[model samples]
Target chain A: MTIADQVTGTPIAGTADTAVRAKTAAPAITLPVVGERELRLDLFRGMALWLIFIDHLPPNLLTWFTIRNYGFSDATEIFIFISGYTAAFVYGRAMLESGFVIATARILRRVWQIYVAHVFLFTIFLAEISYVATRFENPLYTEEMGIMDFLKQPDVTIVQALLLRFRPVNMDVLPLYIVLMLALPLILWLMKWRPDVSLGLSVLLYVVTWQFDLYFSAYPNGFWAFNPLAWQLLFVFGAWCALGGAKRMSRILASPVTMWIAIAYLVASFYVTMTWYVPQLGHFMPKRIEQWMYPIDKTDLDVLRFTHFLALAALTVRFLPRTWPGLRSPWLRPLILCGQHSLEIFCLGVFLAFAGHFILAEVSGGPVMHALISLSGILIMWGMAWLISWYKSEADKSGSKTKNAVSNADMAGGG
Target chain B: MKAKVLLSLILLCGCVAASSARAEDAVPAGPPACEVPAYLLTTESQLPKTAEIIRDNKPLEILVIGSRSTAIPSSEDSSYPARLQAILKEKLPSEPVHVSVEIQSKKTAEEAASGFVKLMEAKKPTLVIWQTGTVDAIRSIDPDEFRSAVTDGVSALQQAGADVVLMNLQYSPRTETMMSVPPYLDNMRVVAQEHEIPLFDRFAIMRQWNDQGQFDLFNPTRGSELAKQVHDCLGRALAQFVIDAAHVGPAQQQN
Candidate 1:
């Protein structure tokens, strides 16, 4: 098999090889594309996703200290870049070690994951709306809830709500993630397993998105809430850096130059976010940005929100410790272990959030009760995560024992 | 842990107190609880000035009556009457004076004066202001009654040894259909010249805003175009009237 055809265990490996090797020269910094395999990047991806969850929650006590409302809460922007970054890291490595076939399959799998996540979150959002509409006391309870009455239709307006809600400005991002994952494997394959070609396309996607507003978009309705297409280039750049492939970039990061730059960025983000961006919190305080941030408006991502998120994310990467603090400590090991199995943690978090909302949310109380409510929410989530991890560990141990027993029986039968 | 909790509690209380204190300062105090003064102001600087120059050396008690919160005060300090009081305080501090105003809605000049009979009796004020006639239009109380009420109210004050300044009332362009008193503002000059009461024509101020682009002297919008014009006009009028009246010397300064 030609270099591209030497497939790995995963089907997308060949294509992953091609994508990782592709390259594009950007003036700011050089990042060598890592072959498709970096678990640390996964940790970042998971962290970004987690931040998004917290960001989505209504601002109250826990979120207050968070730079969330500030311009720097660009946690969402980091998710997009990391999404692309991992694609090149994983898919490119797969392609080089294995083949295009493995790369393609893995790409589809990632895409499917995004679609599932979207559907799940969308349903959760819709369910919350229904709960509020039905349960809340609207004084105008009788006025022809005419159009609003459609909210009563069980799942009737689900499709329309998805389209019309226009939330997550930068529409269809969840779906976009899936589609990009699918297409990326091929894009990687076509790059002839070269870093330049893969990265060049990613940069091109970013440029088109940033300057030209290129996304599958409507006038305003379909503006991409998270312009992954544009942000993908940053991922490609970071991937290059992680692999130690971008020679010029590696030198810069090693030099004192990057340290100062990172420091300056950190200070600037803090200043702008606290002083300038605080007041703008009231702008998003109202629940109105829902209409265009969803569906498929890829073109209309908010420039303000996107740029701020990117700046903050970059600063964090440039400065925050590579490994989480206290992660190796025995007392804190459980939490880091949970992080290792993030999908399980996510599922448990969702379940816990729902249960807490249903059980404790209606109990009306002021700040004291609210503090308790939030406290319970955090504790409940952690509890569920611990339980799930424990169950998984037990099940795996049992499965290993059963497998060993069957193997011994087979050997005895042959004797 | 208890100490920490107590510290937190102290911090929380401090925050609450600070926020509330700031809010209180943010809004300037409104009219006092009782026996408040209403504003007296002129709409235009060019208009003739009227000040109830005290002759017998009694403190001038000025009262302004109005329709609503937004109604024109004689001046910006709520009424030109108050400004008159301020000037009196500055120029004649030892004159044993107290200037007071009361704003009332739905009262005719006679009604306003009659209500103040006890106050007039108590304060024995030497200066009276009759701001009515708009209500006369609203009630369509007889025009003759309006004229007589003005006369009677003024006579009542003067009989009590107080001089009077009448503020003629006008309708906003808003009240064409509701008013039945035949727009008394139009005929105020007749009453003032006939009664020989120094009528501060607030009506003229409205006319200036409508005709000459001179804004409402008491725009009430606080520094809005209307408010600025009223403030300017009333201040100038109060200043000029006081100066002119001073020239007449304290003896001839009567209603």
Candidate 2:
């Protein structure tokens, strides 16, 4: 079987002799194309993006329903982990079929694209916050959104913004993504040659970052909010799973013993998280244990957070099987669409979050207002995703038509 | 080596000249009464470490961690921390002072407090001016939780050997009408009193300025220009407040 078949878990039609012959004659080797997208990745990623939007707008009542209230890991872990899985699935195939040079070029091009999107998003986000602050005659908005630097020293701040250093508030995640994407080529190469070694290296980096206090410095002050060195472990682990690690551990993944352990861990996390709402019950735990787990550092990807995320992922995969009928339900279509166009949806979500905050502050910010703003923002996101998907589909149809016509003309000329 | 020495000499001369001018500018003989309101003044005992640092001719490092409004206008020289540094330097010309601002992005007091230990370790500032309560007030976080978070943050700063000063919420006419802030403000004061740390009553001070006809904070068109003036005044008041808290005076100056 081809490496693509091995990675994607798709069965090959040809015999072992045919596969051997194809491998010897590179011209005969055809890569196994992924005809269908992974529903689980898209569904969860879309949901996580929406949750991130709601969670960012503080004081909104919608935050209560987010996964964070019931688990140690929040939407951030889900988003980053899915990002890793998707990146590996997409790019690993390129490395296998098109050769390393083409794969490196493609990855770098993607990094550049993400970098540009980040800068564009930052500019638009600043403009939005600044306009609201000025229009409402409230300078506090600038301060609240972390855009005061740009207002004060546009020259220096613009440079820092370009370098992905001066991230204001919600702008930190894109910079983290940019850094991770830049390192994807090396990660893919290592995984291609030595999967275990690649994962080991990732773990080593995370441990060193935690033990030795290593992190990239942010511009005009402190360290990066999401420390890439520490967070890369989750991203790498996701990639490993996509690159045959999941299949290698298929027995363990399906084991009843493993399933029980995941469920138990999730239940415990739920109990612990629920206590946060009830202070008395929160303190019911022993003082020493509470103190040790008091500040689970989100920036450095604390061990508790990592373990909690793994447990959550395991439980999710077990419960929400790939062929679950609900994945194709009309009710879930919007979420699936948003997940399909995640990058665009994420950018829209950031803008909507800022808009939501402004609206909450301007309006009564009561329960009714919060509900209205959240529903409106989410609908807008879904609408935009649908529009983009429609446009892409139309473009694809037109291109295919043109190709077909050209082929017919060539055949007629040969006759 | 020679270039370094020459640069150092130039810097020393510039510092002396700047200090002399600042001393001249420090005199507030003709300013309006509302500009330096009595309610803004703190009679708490001086911060021993701050005073000692100034006395030793060392650069007093002050870290101001708060919302953007309290610290922004990005011109490092115009920020409250920068203004405070200038005010302190004018008061004690021989002592070089540096103020750094760290913007708190977290909305709740607890979330803001979570970063205190990390920041304290990183910055190693002799003084930490924590501006909080605005987000919590807007969100209507539980009063008890807000109190506990403030207390924990203060305790963490103290343990890190940094003097802690809590600054309450900014007075926004628009926000005031929209949400109640009494619980958060009262809780902050109680925490301050319990911890023996001085609470900078920014909300009251701003309210007084509006009530006393010092600044028309309600004016919607002024935007950042008005904010600049208010921040400048706040920086001056905070400088004096810190100096008084530190018990630094002409007599305490290092010769």
Q: Provide chain B TM-scores across all predictions.
A: 0.59, 0.83
lDDT of 2 by residue, A121-189 (tens): 778866764655455645534433232334677789789889887776677788898788788889988
- Residue B148 in model 2: lDDT: 91
lDDT, candidate 1, B176-210, per-residue tens: 21122223553443455444556665544343333
TM-scores, one per candidate: 0.48, 0.62
Evaluate residue B142 in candidate 2 and report its C-alpha lDDT on the 0 to 100 scale: 48
Each prediction's RMSD over C-alphas, in Å, is 21.8, 15.2
Candidate with best DockQ? 2
Candidate number achieving the greatest lDDT relative to the actual structure: 2
Q: Could you say which candidate leads in TM-score?
A: 2
